[model samples]
Target: MLRLRLVTWDVKDTLLRLREPVGLSYAAEARSHGVQLQPEALSRAFRAAYAAQSRRFPNYGRAEGLSSRQWWLEVAMETFRLSGVREDAVLALMAENLYRDYCNAHSWELLPGASETLSCCRRRGLRMGVVSNFDNRLESILLRCGLRHHFHFVLTSEAAGVAKPDPEIFRTALRLGGALPEQAAHVGDDYSRDYRAAREAGMHSFLLHGHGRSAGPEVPPGHVLPTLSHLLALIEKG
Candidate 1:
């Protein structure tokens, strides 16, 4: 039987998701500053800007001396610039609003079964922590979402100096949990970052299937969970 003691979770898209589309949020911010941007266009531009920023400043630029807020401001600026908003003043205003707006719980919603999963883990005497490629604001967001108390610790990429799929973050989680890799399990929606990375780290991993979405045939049957509720059975069986 698997001796599961620690369960580390990936936050974004795993435990919680944005309440609205990124583009809608960004466009709202733009509108506040007298700019009208198509939400779809802004969303696409944001994705591009975020990817470029990640390549340039991985882990929120922790090693490069950029604070989380500063790094995000850079991403926002790049996002606006890519979407054809060149005015520095306007870019700053929009980005600043976005940064502030996203920090609150209103910006995010707990995923289905998230609370029940955590409560079940707690009932099973499991220790839980968060392992995510997020910035310092993660704790605050969790707190506002009323999920902060469920975790023993919250580890972010900015705090760890590395992101998921690097393995170092998983190692850090092991140290925090005081468990061997085999004594822990990880669950997340992303295959490479969460499932594969955790498996490579010697822990059991599960890829969460989207609601009303089917798992691809390529995924191992046992490793893809239909919902967080399925996780309870895994723990019980183990």
Candidate 2:
């Protein structure tokens, strides 16, 4: 029997999310400036921008503290740039506005039943920590959702000096959990970042595919648990 003592989690999309698709927030913020762009387009652009920014600033947390906001501003600008907003002035304006808008707590909410899952883990005596590719704002966000108490520590990419899928962040979480890789489990929604990365780090990983099933012959077997409730059951049974 495998002994498990620690459980580390990814924050965004795993524990909580915006009430609507992220694009809606982008659209809403853009509309205030008389900008009319499709949310779908903006969504794609935003993801691409964030990914690119990550590659450019692979060691953000080690850099100046202001790097967080600067990185986000770059991503926001890239979103507009990809959306066909060619004017530099307009792009800068949108980036600043959108960055400010995202900082507000009104833009996010806890995922359904997430609290119950965390509570269940607590009752099971599992040591929990958080590993995420987020900025400093993440601590405040978790606190607002009443999840701060459940986690023993929160490790963000901006603080770990590394992000997910890189394995460095997972290593940090393990250190915080005070367990060997085999004695801990990692949970997240991203396949590569959470599943593949944790698997490579020698930790058991659970992929939570919310709202549907995604298993296929090509997909790796025995990792998709899909719901926090199922994850809790597995940890409890172990």
* Candidate with maximal TM-score: 1
lDDT scores in order: 0.89, 0.81
Model 1 has an lDDT value of 0.89
Candidate 1: which stretches are off by over 4 Å? 211-218
Per-residue lDDT tens digits for candidate 2, residues 1-238, read 3478899999888898877776777787778878898999989988998788767666453465557877788888888888878878877887888776665677778777789989988887889999998888888888876899999999998888777899878888889889999999998888888888988889988888886757445335456666777886665455
lDDT score, residue 151, model 2? 94
Model 1 is weakest, by summed lDDT over 10 consecutive residues, at 211-220
TM-score of each: 0.95, 0.85
Residue 158 of model 2 has an lDDT of 82
What's model 2's lDDT at 161?
A: 78
